[model samples]
Each structure stands twice: as C-alpha cells, then as structure tokens.
Target: MAGKRTNSNLAGELLIELRRDDAVPLHRQIEASIRAGVRSGRLPLGSSLPPTRAIAADLGVSRGVIVEAYQQLVAEGYLTSRPGGYTQVAIGPEPAAEPVRTEPKRVPRIDFGYGRADVSSFPRAAWLRSIRRVLTEAPNDRFGYLNGRGVPELHDAIADYLNRVRGTSADPGDVVICNGYAQGVSLLVQVLVRSGAKRLAVEDPSADDDVRPVAVAAGLEVVGIPVDRDGVRVDALDRTDADALVLTPSHQWPTGGVLSAESRAAVLKWAGDRGALVIEDDYDAEYRYDRAPIGAMQGLAPDRVVYAGTASKTLAPGLRLAWLVVPRRLVGDVVQAKVAADRGSPVIDQLTFADFLSRGEFDRHLRRMRPVYRRRRDVLLEALRDRTPGLEPAGIAAGLHLVAWLPDDLSETAVVETAARRGLGVYGVGPYRMSGGGPGGLIFGYSTLSERTITDGIAMLAEVIDEVRAG
Candidate 1:
C-alpha cells in the first residue's frame, strides 16, 4: 500500500506516465520507469515499491501489467521478494566497484612464533557448565555495578589462588581484576607516574613486547638491563637511576633464564635500598615443564613487589581476565586507576571464573595441559638438536618456547627468511631487544603445534639451514 496517492500525486513520486502515442506498451513504460528509478537512486536499495493493485488503479491499467513489470525487474536482479515479505529494491542498476585481483600470498605451513597458546584445548564444556551455574544461582545484586575492584567472589578467588599457588602474600582487598595484562601494565604505569616516578627498567630480551611502549606513552624513560644465563644483571642496577623495574623471575621470557638466587637477592636488596618498586609479571607460570617452577618474587618482599598474573595463558586470551596483587599501601591508588580506566571488567565473566576457580577446575585444566605441552617442548628441542647443530636452543627448562641462539655467522634475519621460503615460520628476538645488543637467536613456540607438525617443520627448517650454508 506504499505511495497510496491520487492520480495527480502518483506521477511526481513514482514518475510513471503511460506513453500510448509512442507505440510503447503500458507494461513496458512502467518497467522502463522503474529501471530508471533504480539507476538514478530514486528507488534506493531496500525501498519498497507500491503494491501492484494500487499502482495499476492509479495508471488506469490492469493489475497484471504492474505485476508483469515487477516480475521482470525481479528476474533481472533489480528487485527482490521473500515469502510473506515485502518486494523491495534488491540492488542498484550500477553495481559496486569490484576489487582488483592480485597474486595470492602463500600461508606458512608451520609457525613457531611466541605469545600463542593451545586455544583448541579451551575448556568449552567446563566453561559453559560454569556459566550455566552462575546464571542460574547468582544473586540479582551480582549483576549490578557493585564494586570497582571486581566481583568480591573473583577478588577472593584470585587472591587465594595466588597466595596458595604462586606463594605471594595476597589478600582479597589487595586484588584488582583487569581486562588483561596489557591494561594491568597501563594502570600500573599511570599509578607509578602519579607517584613522582620517572624511570623504569625491563629485561633486555623479555617476551613482553608491550611494556616498553606502554611505559614510554606514560612519559617514563625505559632502560633495558642485560640478561645472562642466570637472568638479569643485578650488579648493573647501581649504575642507573630507575624508579622501578619489571621482572619475570619465575621463568624469564624469551631467554628462558631463571634469576639466580644471588641476582634475586641482589635485586631485592637494591630495591629496598633505593626505594624502588618491582613489578613481577608472572607470564606463563603454570606451564613449567621441569620439576616445580620457582615461586613468585613477590613472596620475598610483598610490600615492595607487585605481582601480576593473567588467565590468558591458562585460559583463552579472548576471555580477557587478569589480576594484580597490589601492595596494601598502593591498593587505594590502584583501585582509583581501575575506576578511571573501564570501571571494571565484565561481571559475568568474573563470576564464572570465580566459580571455575572455587571448584578446582582451573587446577585440573593446568594439570592436564602441562604434560601435553612438555611432550611438545621436548619434541621441538630434540628435533632442533639433531637437525640444526649450529643453532643452540636454550631456555627449555620452563614456559611454552625455547630460544635457539644462532652462531655468529648466521644472522637472525637469514634463518627466519630461509625458513619462511620452506613454508616454516620462525621468530627472532631482535625486535624484543633494546639499545644493548644481545646475541642473535630465534624463538620457537610449540604450545599449539602437534608433534608430527613440529617434527616435520623442524626437519624442513634443517633443510633450509643446510641450503643457506651451501650458498
């Protein structure tokens, strides 16, 4: 019934006038008018035309004439109709610009880049069950904007889990749930800047690629300390005037070096003496392949160290759940920062995670994943050892990846490029390095790839290395 108008009003809106003297049939004139309307944008896409009976009465023609014209336009792709739905303009007469075709790039067969987890193993069934339980039993108050710190249940769960598992001195009040480690770092940087802090130090070869840029954005200068076989060089701490330092002591990222007891103690003593803060990023602490991994550094001096952990490593990163064990003194400022930043993370996810943790489901998931990841790590290390004797693979003790240090003759770029040509993807730590240069190395992540794929990929890489050597 659209455009239900008198004879005079119909001509301006639909712009259709039967040309009897021109020898054109009435149906053809109607069809031509509609076609012109579509091309001129008069009847834009999704616009409904008048019903057949209404238009036929206005034009003093039979309804079959209008129907025939509409049917022809529909067949020509200018109109569309659905079952029990309105007949609307389907497309413009002139089609959209077609994208130009170019040569398609080939995808790599095997990738060993860092920061990837075995997401295929995500606990979908268990998570769904937990979500169902939360939805069915959670109180009405749980969904409201009750706390800026996070859901109390999640706060308690995270604090208790950290104290018991990571050996950190955490209390429910001192925990703050964040979107992820990225937001946690940003919030910490903001809080530190407000406290008159100006400079920060990070490990030279850590896997955390965002901390330096985040710190610089907050107007803090970053100084990279060199990492040796025994973790960071603590003796060099006296040389720089850093307000704080971020350390991955449990299992140092990329380099795979554990902070020796001497360096650990030295760093703590230096922090205490210099009145500096230490942010301990417990990245991938749960997947330690060897014997039990080292405890968190925050346990040594809770007042001076801020412990940060995320579910992104254990669970899927898409979950966006992370927690920080703030010192009692800094709790107020940290919570204020969280309030300014998104208020708080989603409540339902927090509650579901709380339920997941309280039921010991998280522990079970980690236990199931450890052995699987260990086997993959072992396979990667064994293959690299047999195939590429020149490349030395280190840091196989813990975490998801191992660092293969290339000989001085082979650059990181050469190994990576040669491997790519053979359908293998490998990463270099050069991007992670700061001004202080470190030995060239490739980081191999094996958390997601299968054993057969790992073996074949490493074999192919061996062939590529041989070709590189031959040339």
Candidate 2:
C-alpha cells in the first residue's frame, strides 16, 4: 500500500510504501519509511505527521498498526507528541546528502613509483611468531593506552638496535614512536612551529609531495636547498634563514647520494652556529648495495639532530610503524604533540616489533632481503644500460630509487605523458624541484618490481622515450 501526506511545515510531501507480502510486520515497514523520510529531509523537523486514524484509513491498514508505529517512533525520539498536540518530527541531525562520486584512479601496468617495498618478502611467519609471543607473554597492562613515548620494551629494543647497527647514540628515553615517517615529520613540524621556528629548509628535489605540505600546513615557510651528487649543498643551506633543515643524509631520496663527510660536518657546524635543528630522515639506509650503510648523522650531533627512521622501506608500508630520536630538549614537546595528534601508536604492534627486534628476527630478515634488493638494483642498472643507452642512472649506490637523467633536449613532461599512455609509470624529477634549473630526468624505483619486470619496464620506457623524441 502507498500513502502520501503533505505537512505545511515540511518542504515536500512524505510518501510511505508498504510491502504487503513481506514477512516484516506492516507497522515496522511504516516506522522504517517514516524514519527514512525524516533522515532524508522529506519530512522536515517540526513537520506534523498525519493522524493515526487518517494514515491508517489512507493506507487501508488497521488503526492499531499506525498507532503502534507512531508510539515506537516517539519512544525512539524520531517523533514527538502530547495528548492535545499534533504528532511532529522531533529535533534531529541535518539530512545526509548523497555522496559525491569520483572516478577511480587507473593503476599502470608497470609502475616505477617510489617509496614502496617488496611486500611479498614481508616475513609473515616471523611476524606471526612475534604477535603470538606478545599475546601469550605480554602482561595484562600491555593492552592499555600507552604514553606517546611508546612502550619501554620497544624503546629499549630500538635504542639497542640503532646503537649497534646504525651507530646512533640513542637512548630509550629520547625515542618517540609514531605511526610512520609522514606522521613523525608532522609531529616534529608541530614541535618546531611551537618552538618559534619560522622557516624549514628541505632538500630540493626531495620528497616535496610528502614533507613540504606538512611544513606549509603548520605555517612554516618552506625553503628548498639544492641537492647535488653528494646530498644537500651545505653552502646553499648556510645562506637560508630556515630554522630547521630536514635531509636524508644516509641515502638521499631520488638522487640516492650519501652526504659527504665534509658536507655533514659543515651542515652540523652551521646548525650549531645558528642554533638551528637538523632533521635526519634515514630513508632506505638498510639496502646499501656498494658498501656498508653510512651511520646516521644523528650520532654526530644527537643534541642537534632529530633522526627519523621507519620500517616502511625494509618491511611493509602497511605496518605504519616508525620512530623519531628526538633531542632531550624537544622530547617533552614532541610527546605532547603526539598525544594530541594520536593518543599513541598501537600497543600490540609496538610490543610485537619489540619482541621481533630483541629476538634478532629483524636482523635475519634484513640480511635475507638485502641481497635480493641488491640484485634488483643491479638488474635495473643493467637494463638501463642495455635498453636506454642515452639515459644515465645516478644515485644507485643505495636506496630503492635512482634518477635517470634525460637528455637536455627531452621534455620531462612529454616523456612522462607518453610513458603513461603506454601503461608505463615513470615519475619525473621536475615536480620535486622547488627552484632549480637542471636537465630533466625520470625516477625509477626497483624495490617492488621483479628483475624481469624491471627489464621489460625499462624496454617499454625506452620505446616511449623514442616515440616522444621522434615527435
């Protein structure tokens, strides 16, 4: 049965449709229809509903059915009524409009997008073992809300690991566990802003998409310092009025250049002289192919550098686990900001990671994957040489990605567009630059791609480049 009622106060008429053959009670159907109408704004707030008897007569249903529906709705606060007053819609939330639809992003056939790890190599068995151990052995309090500094077990493990492996002079007390690198940077940005820092200098041709916006959103003027083959230009940075500088000194992003000893010392001296802070993003320092990974710059000036590290590159980005070794002076403020941003990282994950680290499972996993990544990197370099002879791949000494310099005459945009049309996803270095004039290049990430796939992708990219050059 269908019934319609017009209320003067409502913008439109309320319509109810009843399915007579369905097993659901007729009263429930009527109640649901009225609730939907109210929520969708067909029956506006304070709009009088039809009398029970009138609606019952209109729908050809028993008067008791209408009365029961009205009574239930009234009890649920969807309607209001008094003995002498008209039954009307009670105060409720504003109507929910239909959601806006957007086109889904297309996934390229062979994506060389950076910042992804080999997820297939994620040690599932070891992770499960750690989780099981945590669940079985952890104290009852381990499940409770932890302080923003994270669990002590994890802190101790990280401190020990960093000191022994990365040569960081980390203390458990100075570690602030965060969700990932992005959040760690965000939290640090907050502390920097709160400490009266007005400008933040980042490595130009760095991860601008990730770090710059975070600084900008926090009202800090972001300055771009040029990065060459030996990481960030310390001379250029010395000229900037930036209060803090964030650099990937271990293995620079995209460029893959390890900051030289002279540059590191110079930058630290500059920081010391200006009373500024340096943020060390130790990104992709684990899978160094040519030599032992450089020790974190934070160790040189623990009080001056805020070192950030993450498991995203080594294990999987899905874990969303990373940590910051903040200086003692900024520890309290960073912890407070972390609490305000997110009460804390998940306790279970932290406990599990702590267990994993203590047991040397993390070390074993890295040992196993390091050679695999090295092989892939070699394959990528070989493919570039064999297929794209004109392009010179730099920054291959470390990191998951490297910059393949395009010829001076080639337009980065044209090559990128042509590669996209061919279902080959290669990123150009043009977007990462804030201010610089240099030859255009493509950023090729090999971590997620297999050797065969990397070879094929490079061949495909070569054809695309040829097409672009011909045009």
Candidate 1: list runs displaced more than 4 Å.
Answer: 1-106
lDDT of 2 by residue, 1-471 (tens): 124334443322557788999999999999999998888776767778877877888788999999999999999999999997678888655757789999987789999988889999999999999999999999999788888899999999999999999999999999999999999999998989988999999988888776788889989999889999888998898899889999989888778788988899999999999899999999778887887668998999999999999999998999999999999999999999999998999999999999999999999999998888889989999999999898988988887888999988789999999989889999999888888687799999888888999999999988998898899
Please provide, for model 1 over 1-471, each residue's C-alpha lDDT reduced to its tens digit, 9 standing for 90 to 100. 455333343335778978778888888898899999888877777677777878888888899999999899899898887766666888865765799999898678898867767899999889999999999999999888865689999988888888899888888998988999999988999999999999999988775566888889889999988888668888777676899999988778878888877788889998999899999999788888776668888889989999999988888889999988888999889888999988888999999999999999999999899999999999998898888888898888888888999898887888888888888999898978886467888899999999999999889988887787787
Please give the clash total of every predicted structure, in order. Answer: 0, 0
Candidate 2 runs further than 4 Å off: 1-104
Clashing pairs in 1: none
Work out candidate 2's RMSD over C-alphas. Answer: 8.3
lDDT of 2 at 317: 95
lDDT over C-alpha atoms for residue 28 of model 1: 88
User: Which candidate number has the best TM-score?
Assistant: 2
